[model samples]
Target chain A: MPRGQPPLSLPALIYEPKVRGIIFQVLLLAALVVAAWSLASNVAVNLQRQNIASGFGFLDRTAGFEISQQLIDFKPTDNYGRAFVVGLLNTLLVAGLGIVFATILGFTVGVARLSSNWIVSRLALAFVEVVRNMPPLLTLFLVYFAAIKTLPGPRQSIELPLSSFLNVRGLYMPKPQWLDGSSTIVVAFIAGIIASMLLARWARQRQVATGQQVPIFWPSLGLVLGLPLLAFMIAGQPVAFEYPALKGFNFSGGMVVQPEFIALLFGLTVYTAAFIAEIVRAGISGVPKGQKEAAAALGLSAGQSMRLVVLPQAMRIVIPPLTNQFLNLTKNSSLAVAIGYPDLVSVFAGTVLNNTNQAIECILITMGVYLVLSIVTSIGMNMFNARMALVER
Target chain B: MDAGIRNRRIAITTAALLAVAAGPAMAQTKTLDTVKARGTLNCGVNTGLAGFSMPDDKGQWTGLDVDLCRAVAAAVFKDATKVKYVPLTAKERFTALQSGEVDMLSRNTTWTMSRDTSAGLSFVGVNYFDGQGFMVKKSLGLKSAKELDGATICVQTGTTTELNVTDFFRANKLNYKPVVFEKLDETVAAYNSGRCDAFTSDHSQLYSERLKSPKPDDNVVLPDVISKEPLGPAVRQGDSGWGNVVRWAHFAMVNAEELGVTSKTVDEMQASANPEIRRLLGKEGDFGKGMGLDNDWAYQIVKQVGNYGEAFDRNVGAGSRLNIARGQNALWTKGGLQYGMPIR
Candidate 1:
């Protein structure tokens, strides 16, 4: 109401929406910082009074315990830091293997559920219903307790095809033993793959330009396969097989996949596959029927219609949901602890916490590892999803 | 504009009122007085470990550790019924004590140096002498623990038992793979399922677990004792008054046992002519006053829960299913490690 040229310029500036928002946000941030500082100081005071050391220095100490399952060489005399890495690698191995098997089983069941036969469709539906209804922990127990433990011991090992033995101890199979000059053979095999890919690209361009078909498939396959075999022969067959044999009391001389790993993988795959099957079904159903009809109108067969016209579009919808199931499978691998599998949480967090009495440190480290793994997985999947997304012209 | 300022003033006044309403109870300083006024004592116990702490078919807890808690309540209130038992697990026990969920912990917890210092807890006294040992299936023909080299041992997590097993194996230069489970029941099940070659824990727990097994005679515990495990009661640190009360309550039971006292004949002992008996049974002096209890406190405790030896024999002693001898848990006068302070 003042008639002066300037009527409270700063106050008017402060009343602007942007300025007010900035001020409010600053006040909130300051309040949170102060609150966090107070909590930190309170905890520090309590810890000081209790005379408990709070730092990461304890990581250098010897672990003084053995891990039941390890991917890398480890000993009780190793430091806690190394033990954490071993546990992390074990977790990743289970998660990776689980993802592969779950995807295979899930896609199969998803396709079977859409089959023309009533019995096949119903069987697929029943599998998804039964598995997804049960808790993952219960499934883990069922696999470990009922399925794996019911197997006979090494002396009565069930002989399978290809010189594999299934028993309570483990699945004993022949492992590939790399002899001398195997590295040169591997390099030649990789070189052969690159050459075949280049040759296929050249063949595709030639066919496009000259209107003449080139039989590139069989030649590329022979280049990839025959070259590797030729390299192996040139190197005097530098790969040997070590078959598992029943010793006095146990199987020896082969790679033994422990029952713990099998049960955990079986549980994770079954549980995740059920959820993934639903996602796949939803994605396939999302593809319009018109696309299939149009493909058939173009003189394409049913299988060709699905593979060429529908599946690519359906995968665009399927991949995003499928990534979520993958993440869940990764996190659910922590349930391996229930059956005494030495996953990250089991070997590093639980056992290490008990041995060192460093609950806060061990739990924080374990959770940090999981968080990093989740973030990396999500980022990678998002990148993949972006690549698979339809590009509009 | 002036009315808006008045509204702001009123809002500020209400905000101050809410802050005061949401403040903490501020009753911590009156804890001692409140406990004294309340007749009963709330004691925390282990849920079920047959001889140490377990409820019978009638839902009444009757074990050596449970009796120790009842003894403390009887000492405080002169009535055994004044005790309330709160069951706790290994993970929840210390937190329950720190948060004042129970007056004391009478579970069979080991009194370790780190727990005494870093866990914000205080051990009252060692009530039972125990050790970590291994048990194996008799079919394995494992005559000694040393025979179990490179064996997979099932152990429960979150307890000192795991650390002891590791240390024992390391010191003996033997290799082992540990299959750790969060719960003792799961570990025992894993061992019974042959997922593990051996099971390791406190020797007393091995005995209790063997009894609960479907075929108790099929498994045999090795004779080698690996580590000393002093099981006792505990209370929160910074409350020496409560700590002393619990400590002396355990001492009273052991001292009464040493002086030929039993729950059945405590009244007769109180009437006896012996000076030590008169002092212990609260017939002569004000010994219980120092512990914040009545003059007849020791008399009530001994009368309600019996002596230490009687409590032990009834639960895990020579006559029980465990059939454990009074080796180190016997009185110091009988050349064992148990030595209690004189009641005088």
Candidate 2:
């Protein structure tokens, strides 16, 4: 009877539909847990032997290091937590500014790549071709070492427009001196923004009711610009300018933007714009050609057709990937360590880790920061994407 | 029937847990054993620190810290050249040591309380007793560091010297801006390009870096010594046996210098009637053996790498281009800080 039994089939188990997935998933979960536990215990023993303290208590100690740029009041005597805030703010500042500039440049280049003029298209193609193929670190080095290194020294700072000077130290610009009673002008600027929003809403409604389009663009700009100017004049121009004049060793009266910060910003912008340009080009190309023809058939000009029909659809495809570029730009800002820009990774993870010798704690904190930043960015972008998504009539 | 299978599963899981728990002991070899098995000492050093530890024109590493690495190798391997030099930056030096990337770290790093207690490093002994100083152009007509008010200072990032400069400027009630670069060469380049009015570092570093300036004579190190920076060779904290070898290697150099044992006179001094010299030259006692080394380990170190004074003058002091004074780095018998323990 036993000799007549069939042979065991091993591969037959995976073919069982319900049992198959559970077995695979259970095996994966067990493997992950075992691997993680082993790693944790190994790290624990190694850390104990090495005498490296593990925990976040190091964050509470005085940083005892000077930070060059801070948005809030900070000194060398401040705690490490404050130092981290300064670094995080700097990272956010660079990321925000870099996103704005990169998007503008990317969209411009992406459109130029499809330009009717051959030279324009070729130049755009060459720019993307050269920049995208290069590594970000090399771009940073080139900007810092080659480009910024060529700037004149402090003694022979090259003067620029708008009372600015370029030197090896940094770019120095006139500081805006907010005099007494400048609050009223700021209040009026806020009022101007609110009034424009209301006016646009009313105009949209008026068009829906009467089919008469109000000229909104120039009027909105004039309102915002004129309201601020009128307020400034009414308050007797409460903002003075302190121009940078060559003093002892540097320009004394104005602000000195560090070459490191500028170089990093330049590197991030140049590198990220290349990727974004491709995204934009793909997004625009994804829009069907018939849509442009439809806009033209409706008696719109070439620019109007593009603005009214193609760009709206293109943006739907463009935004999701554009958010990815923004995140990449944010993460790539960590390369500031190579150039010494004091970004979050460079300052909080690097200098503080060096000072405190708490690698695990510092790294976890840095990882947590980047995780939160990326998550928040993704959330905001998803919300924006949802708003622009198609809706059934 | 189910209980039998459950027992087997539990036994397997327990064994796996035990293996991982024993990982620290099983996975790592002590630096001493690794170095012996590898036959070449990995010595982490500065990439190029002029007088402290920089390569010569022939690409051979030569400097004060390089000599310390050689001295340790000689003590262990009886051959000075049996060392693999690992060039590291200021930020990387401590991490390299902590992670066991090098057997001994012979960089121009200062021995600070935080580094000792927090970074899991044990400094063997002070090899260079330096103080922070500044170098400013003579054309500025600045005679003293105190007069450097509102001066922009260029410094290497991730150095205690940077913090020292900050402390000094703040203590003196001076308003100074610090421009930091990631490497020493970059810092010097920035200074040379006149990005900053003055460059600050350990006094020895100032003298060495000034040589890189287009007009070395134009920049003068200020008379002020702002902070005490005792540079030394360091080893990881977990292995005292290895630490003892490194510590004694440094001490043997100083004791030889004090006992009048130069590299040339070492062999002859083994035959001397002087008790101290005899013990030092390994003519008496098993001092090196106590430290898990050969009886003639000190002799090997002296014969190969020279004593402290010879290393000092040849690499950084009067004999070299830096022309640094042996001010506080001299033997304690000559009224300096370096004093070796009695060999007995």
Candidate 3:
């Protein structure tokens, strides 16, 4: 109540919300810079005290370690940089395969769980309950130790139906050796594909214009299959089957899928599919019963209702979570280390880090790869989710 | 009012962060001080390498490397049991040592040029002299290492043995595939599953691993020692004073063996009239004090942990599961390469 000549105008300006927020932000930025600087200096001082050269210069050094299951042509004499590429490719390969297989298996199991049959739904329910309760790493251990270890030894490899042998070493199948004229067959098959696509377009237009159907499906199928056979006969059957024969203590002259790769793929797919199945079931159930009834009242068949009506809407609810499953499967591929699959973490971070003693660089690179992979997966998922989003009026 | 409190908080945090990093800039390093302050030495050993460092059912550690750790503990605290064991795999051993996760790494690590020069580590000295060799089934009808060309071999990953095997095959112009695993148990399982034709490791390790096979008698270890693997103890690259402590601790045991001292007789030898024996038992010289240890450091080490000869016999030599001969690990006087320096 004792009024001064100046009514505290400067304090009001200093204590403004906008100015306070700016000050807070600047202080935060300064704090972050200080923290980062101190951490970097700590690392530098430790490296100096230990006389360790810190940089990517060690990547040029000859990596004397051998990675067993490399996707690239990695040799013991290759540099450390090549080792990282090999590891990254292997990680991508397993993640890619795992996502494909898991989507198929998960959708199937989800449909089965939604079935009216008691036995089918119960079986699917049991599978999801058991697997969803267990850890992914434990599932990997079981697939590797219990399942893969029980396969027959190389000498007693089980004869599969398609010239493939199942054994403890791997699944060895016949390799197709292309003699001359194989390219002509492949070109003919591609021509058949183009012809089928054109026929589908023509049939659609004709049906729209004239009140008649062209019956294009059977003809397209015939062209796709028959053209390849016609080309093969014309080429005098240039493909020779080089079946895997037992030579010495192992199989020779064939394509072999190592047990480590199989175990990793199986474990990742099966474990991820359990959770994906639940997501899929929730999406399918989220479609109201009234929607299907409405389609039936419109004189649509059951299959037509599901394919043209229910699934499209259900997928709207399914896609965002499904994208999450895909990312989870990709990140979980790093668990291939447990089975010695030579994935990124195993080959690059585990072995290379130990051999070169460049832990910080190796770890940063590994984390960077995973971060980029995750971001790319999320971006792809976001694109799909946007496409499936509800349309605004 | 708010700015005053926030500024004070910021000052405290900055001070704390700077203080966290100010230790290394001091004139003298403090690895020994840290170990003493912690009261228990963190010793990294193999996860379960039988002769080197394996735990029994009672969780008591006993092996060559384990004994060395106890000797260091005895030398420091005069209490041999004052030690903590960190079980590390081949892939984790170097990092664990370099990061100071363990004060010393007494794992059976092979000393190599790359490991010493670039890996920020220093090999104390050779504790067990070993050589890389091959093991195969008797059913193969292969007699020599050279005859087993184009063979798939099982090897532990992140090891010098893998590089050695690759060099062996390349130098001989042979083709082969290597099946590598992270764990020794997994490597053995893959080999036993008929996934590989041969398993290769140090000769001492081959004997121990072969015993774990289903039919041990059906396998035969090849006689060729392809590479000289001087397996020894390693410490971090810095702290020369601590490195010297670990190195001389092992040397003291070897020297005691050369001086004909044992754990049972070390107390009696302390009353000897001989100058060399008196100096070694810390009666005449203050060498232990120069290393920042008590004058009776060697006495405690020998009295509690025994000499190097006893450790070798009970762990990997003739009295143990390995039953390896003292080819290069015997003392210098016994025509072996285990040369010891003068304790004085």
TM-score for each predicted model, relative to the true structure:
0.88, 0.90, 0.91
lDDT (Cα atoms) of all candidates against the true structure:
0.80, 0.83, 0.84
CAPRI-style docking class of model 3 based on DockQ: acceptable
Per-residue alpha-carbon lDDT of candidate 3 for residues B94-118, written as tens digits (9 for 90 to 100): 7667656688999888999888887
Clash count, one per candidate: 0, 0, 0
Best by lDDT: 3
**DockQ, every prediction:** 0.22, 0.25, 0.31
Please provide, for model 1 over A1-393, each residue's C-alpha lDDT reduced to its tens digit, 9 standing for 90 to 100: 657665658888798789889999999999999877765665555444434445678789888777777789888789888888888998999999999999999988987889899999999999999999998888988888785458886667899998999987778899999999999878887988999899988888998999676888798888888888998999999899999987534577778788889999999999999998988888889999999899999998988887778878888999988988998999889877777788898777666655565555676688788888888888988998898789999
Q: Which RMSD values do the candidates have, in order?
A: 7.8, 7.9, 6.4
Interface RMSD of each: 12.1, 11.4, 9.6
lDDT over C-alpha atoms for residue A206 of model 2? 100
Q: Which clashing pairs does model 3 show?
A: none
The C-alpha stretches of model 2 lying farther than 4 A from their native spots are A1-38, A41-45, A146-148, A153-155, A159-164, A177-181, A205-210, A240-246, A390-393, B1-22, B26-29
Q: Please state the Cα-based DockQ of model 3 relative to the true two-chain complex.
A: 0.31
Candidate 1, clashing residue pairs?
A: none
